[model samples]
Target chain A: MKTKKLINDPKVIIEEMLEGIVAAHPKHVRQVEGAPRAVVALNGPRKGKVGLVIGGGSGHEPTFVGFVGKGLADACPIGNVFASPPPDPIYECAKAASGGAGVLFMYGNYAGDVMNFDMAAEMAGMDEIEVRTVLTTDDIASAPLDQKEKRRGVAGNFFIFKIAGAACDTMKPLDECERLARKANAHTYTMGVCLSPCSLPQTQKYSFELGPDEMEIGMGIHGEPGVAKGPIQTADAVTDAIMDKILGEMKPNKGDKVAVLVNSLGATPLMELYLLNRRVKQRLDQVGVSIHQTWVGNYCTSLEMAGASITLLHLDDELTGLLDHPCDCAMFRAG
Target chain B: MKTKKLINDPKVIIEEMLEGIVAAHPKHVRQVEGAPRAVVALNGPRKGKVGLVIGGGSGHEPTFVGFVGKGLADACPIGNVFASPPPDPIYECAKAASGGAGVLFMYGNYAGDVMNFDMAAEMAGMDEIEVRTVLTTDDIASAPLDQKEKRRGVAGNFFIFKIAGAACDTMKPLDECERLARKANAHTYTMGVCLSPCSLPQTQKYSFELGPDEMEIGMGIHGEPGVAKGPIQTADAVTDAIMDKILGEMKPNKGDKVAVLVNSLGATPLMELYLLNRRVKQRLDQVGVSIHQTWVGNYCTSLEMAGASITLLHLDDELTGLLDHPCDCAMFRAG
Candidate 1:
C-alpha cells in the first residue's frame, strides 16, 4: 500500500515537526538554545519549583512535546519516530528545565529510554544539578503481577504525568514529586488492541503484518508482538476481553473510584473509543467501581496505527485532588 | 474492502454513543429528559442568559456534542450519522436550553440542517421563545466569492461556534450574540483535502471512492465532491493548494493577525497535520499575516475519513478575546 502521508521528506520529518510545533505553540514552548531537539516550556520552570522533564520516541505526539507548558512538563526532549533521544538532548533538557528545587526525568519504561535518560542524569549530576528519574510501567499485559516492574508504559502514562506535573507545579520538593510519580504509576494500568499496522515514515513500510480480518490484543505502541491475535471481534467482546485481564489483577473493592481514559492509538476514531467506553463502564459498574473522571480521545498514539487503549488510574484522595488540579499545556488542559 | 470496525449493531450506534458520552462526562453533559437526541450542558445554561444551541449530523464526533459544556453550547440535538435531526428533538433542545433571554441555533450550511432548524425555530416561536439562526459558510472552495452564501461549512464551524458560545456565555443579548456569530462566520475560511473515504456505520461501506494514488481537494465532511481531483501530491503542494484558495478569499493585509486550526478530518494523524502547519506558517510568513494562536488536532472529524482541513479565523480584539475565553467541554477545552 502507498504511504499516503502529508510530508515533505521522511529524513527531516522530526525537524520539520519540531519546527512546526514551536511555530504553532510559541507561547507555550520553545526550542532550547543550541539544542533543537530539546523543547522547554515557556512558563513552567520557576525558581523554588521542581522541574519536570519528559521525553520518548516521537510518534506518540502530545505525549512528551505537547505536554510542555505551564502546570505540566517543564521540558521535553524529542527523538525520531519510534526511537529514543540521545543523552545530549536529554541532558540539555535537564539543564534548561532545572529550577533551584532540582529536576525529575519521567518517561515510559523502555530499554533505550532508560539507558539514555540514566546517562543524562549522570551528566546533570556532574554539572552539580540534582536529577531524579521515574520510569512509568503501567501496561498490565506486558508482565505478570509478580513481575510488574517489567510492564511497559502506554496510555496510562498520561495520568502519571498529569499527577506528577501537578505536584511539580504546586512547588513540591523533588522527593515529593518523585514519590507522587511512582505512586501514580503504581495505580495506573492500561491495555491496547491493534486492528492494523502503521507504516514508518522513512521506509513507508508496515511495522508488522496481520491478516486483513485479524486483530491483536495487548499490542505495544511500537508494533511489538502482542499477547493474542485472532479474527476481529465486536467492540463489546474485545472490551470484555481486555477488561477481564485488568479487573482480574486490579480487584478493586466496591465504592472505589478511578479515572478512566479510553484513548485512540491513532487511526481509531472517537466513535469506537466511546463504544469501548460503554462496555468498560458496564464492566466497572458490575464490579461496583465508580468512575471519577473520564477522558476519551487521542491522548497517546502510535502514529497512524489503528488501535485503542483503555487506562484506569485508581485514585486516592490525594491523587484525585492532584488529578483535578488546573493544568495548561499545549495539547492538554484540565482542572 | 472489508469493513473492519469496533462496533456492534450499527443500527444503534448513535444511541450507544450517546449512552457512552453521558456515562463518561456525567459532570459536563446529560441527555435531556424525554428527548434522547437532545444533550444539554450541565453548567452552561443560566436563567437570563442567551442560550446557545448547536447541532448537526452525528458523524462529526466532537463537532456538535463534544462542544457542549460550560462557556460553550448550552445544548446539542444529535442527528443520525450524516443526517439531520427532525424538528421535534430540535424544538426540545431549544425549550430545554432557553433561559428567558432567548435561544440561538447554529450549524453548518446544509440543506437538511437548515430546513430542520428552521422548522424548530418556528416551533419555538409558537411557544413565545425568541429564536435566531446563524449558518456557517466557511469552505472557500464550495462556492465563488460572489456566491459566498452558497458555500458549505466545514471545520471552520469550530471557531464560529466558539465565538458565539463565548458571546452567549458572557450574557450578551440575543441580538448581539447573533451579530457576533455572523461576524465570526464571515471572518473564518476553511479548505479540506480527502485522501480516502469513511464507511458509514449502518452500511459498512465506503462513503466515497478515490484511486490509490489520487486525492480530492475541498471535499466536504460527508464525502461531498470537491473542486479539484488528481494524483496525490507532496504535503507542501497540498498545503499550498489549499492555502491559495483560502488566502485569495481572505486577502488579509500584511501585519494582520489570525488564529489557525490545522484540523484532521479523522484518520490523518498529528504528524501530517503539523507538516501541513509547517507549510501553512511558511506561506503566511511570506505574506506577512501573523498567527496569534494555533490549534492542531481532530476538532471536527468525519468518522474515520482520511483527510484534513485548514481553518483560519481572522481575529480582531473582540474575536481574539472571545477565542481566548475559557471553555470547559467534554472534548474540547480551550482558553
Candidate 2:
C-alpha cells in the first residue's frame, strides 16, 4: 500500500517542519545563525547560568525541538529523521546556547549522536568554553541489569531533561547540573510495546512490520528488534508485562513516591493510554508506592507508530521539587 | 483485520478511561457525588463566581474532561463513544459546578447534546440555580453561510472553551460569560480532512470507510459525510484547498491577527501537522494576516482516526486577553 502521509517533498520535510516551529513559537525559539539545524531559546541563555542543550533524531516532534524555551532547553540541535546531526550544527548549538558559565549536552545514548556531540564538545573546548555530557539510558528492556549502561534511552528522556532544565535554570553549577542529570537518569525506567510500524517520509517506506494481531514488546524507537513478539494482549496484560520488568529493577519500598508518564509511541490514542494508566496505578497502589505526579500524552513518539510506553521516575524531596518547578516550552509547560 | 486495541472490555471503556483520568489527576478533578458520569474540578468552582461546565462525547480526549481545572471548566459530563450524555449526568454536573453566581454550559452543537443540555437546564431552573448556554458552531464546512447555525462544532471548541473558562474564572456573571462564549464561537472557523476511519470500542468496527488512496475533506469528527472525496493529494495541495475555504470566509484586513490551531484528529503525527502549519503560515503571510499564537497537537480527536483539522480564531483585544489568561488543566496549561 502507498504510504499515506500529508507531506510534500521529503527532502525539504525537516526544513519545513523547523520553519513551522519557528513561525508558531517566535517568542520561544529562533534558528541559530549559520546553523539551520540548530535552534536556540529566545529567553533561556543568560550569563552566569548553566546552559542546557538537547538534541536527537527528527520525526520525534516536541522531543528535541519543542522543549527549547525559557526554563527548559536553551537550544536544540536537530537531526535528519532518525539520524544524528553532523558535528557542525552541534558546535553551533553549543556556542549559541552557552552562557558564560558553560554548556551541557544531553541526548539519548546512540553511537552517531555520541560521535557527533563529542566532536562538537572538542570544538567547544578549543574555544575555551567548558562543556559536559550526560547520556540517558532509561530503557530497561534494552540491556541486562549488569549491562544497564548499554541500554538505549526512550521516553524517559522527558523526566531527565526536566530535572536538568530545572537545575540549569536555577543557576546550579555545571558539576551540580551534570550530577543531577545522571541521578535523574539512574532513577528512571521505561519499557514500550509496538503494535504497528511507522514509515519514513523520505522513502515512504515502512521501518518495520508486524502482523495485524501482533505486538512487539521492548521495541526501540527506531524499529529496532524487540525482546518479544506475540499476539496482542489486553491493555491490563500489556501494562503488567512492562511494569513487571520496571518494578523488578526499581524495587520501590512502601511509602515511596514516583512520577509517572504514560506516553504514546505515536498513533495510539489517549483512550488507550488512559487504560494503561488505570492498570499502572493499580499495580503501583498494590505496592504502596504513591504517585507524586502523572503525565499522560504523546511526549515521545516514533513517527506514527502505534504503541505506548510507561516511564517511572522514582522521586525524592529534591527530585519532586525539581519535577514541580515552573517551566514553559513551546509544547510542554508545568508549574 | 482484527481491531488492535489495548482495552479490556469495550462495554466498560468509558468508565475505565474516566477512572484512569481521575487517578492520574486527582488534584485537578474528581467524580461528582452520586453522579458517576460527571467530574467536577477540585479547584474551579467558587462562591459568587460564574461556573463553567463543558461536555460532549467520550472519544474527544482533552476536550471537555481534560480542560477541567483551575481557571477552566468547573465540571464535565462525559458520554459514550461518539454519543451525547444523558440528562441526569448533565443535571448533576450543573448542580456540582454551580457557584452562587450561577452556571454557564458550553459544548459543541449537536442534536443529542442540545436536547439533553436543554433538559438539564430545565432541571436546574427548578433548583433555583440560574443557567445559561452557548453552543459552538464553528465548522464552516458543515453548512452554508446563510445557514451558519446549522454548522457543527469541531476542534474550534478549544478556543471557545478557553475564552469562556477565562470569563467565568474572572467572576463574570452568567449573562456576561454566556455572551463572551457566543462571541468567541462567532469568531472561530474550522475545517477537517479524514484519511482513515476509527473503530468503535464496543463493536470494534470501523466508523467509516475510504479507499487506500482516498481522503475526504470537510468530514465531521463522527465520520459524517464530507463535502468532497478524492485520491489523496500532496500536503501543499490539501492545505491550499482547506485554506481557500477559510480565507473566503474570513476576509481580514491587512495586519489582522488570529490564533491558529493545527489539530490531529487522531492517528496523524506532529510531522504532518507541522507541514500543514508551514503552509498555513505561508498562506496567512500572503494575505498580510499575522498569527498571534499557534497550537499544533491532538487537542480534539476522533478515537484512532487518521485526519487533521485547521481552526482559526479571529482575535480582538478581549479575546486575545482571555486566550492569554492563566489556565491549569489536566491535559492543557497556559500562562
Winner by lDDT:
2
Clashing pairs in 2: none
* DockQ-derived CAPRI band for the predicted complex in model 1: medium
lDDT by residue for model 2 (A1-335), tens:
87788989998899999998888889888999888889999999999988999998998877989898888899999899999998889999888988889899999999999999999999999998889999999999899999988999899999999999999999999999999999999999999999999999887789778998999999999998888999999999999999999999999999999999999988899999999999999999999999999999999999888999999999999988889888888888888
True contacts kept of each: 0.69, 0.75
* Model 1 per-residue lDDT tens digits across residues A247-280: 8877899999999999998888888899999999
What is the C-alpha lDDT profile of model 2 across B1-335, one tens digit per residue?
A: 76788899889999999999999999999999899899999999989989888999999997879999998899999999989999999999999888878999899999999999999999999999899988999998899999998999999999999999999999988888988999999999999999999998888789778998999999999998999999998888989999999989988889999999999998899989989999999999999999999999999999888989999999999999999999988888887
Task: Kindly give the stretch of ten consecutive residues in candidate 2 chain B with the minimal lDDT sum.
Answer: B1-10
Off by over 4 Å in 1: none
Task: Give the Cα-based TM-score of candidate 1 against the true structure.
Answer: 0.98
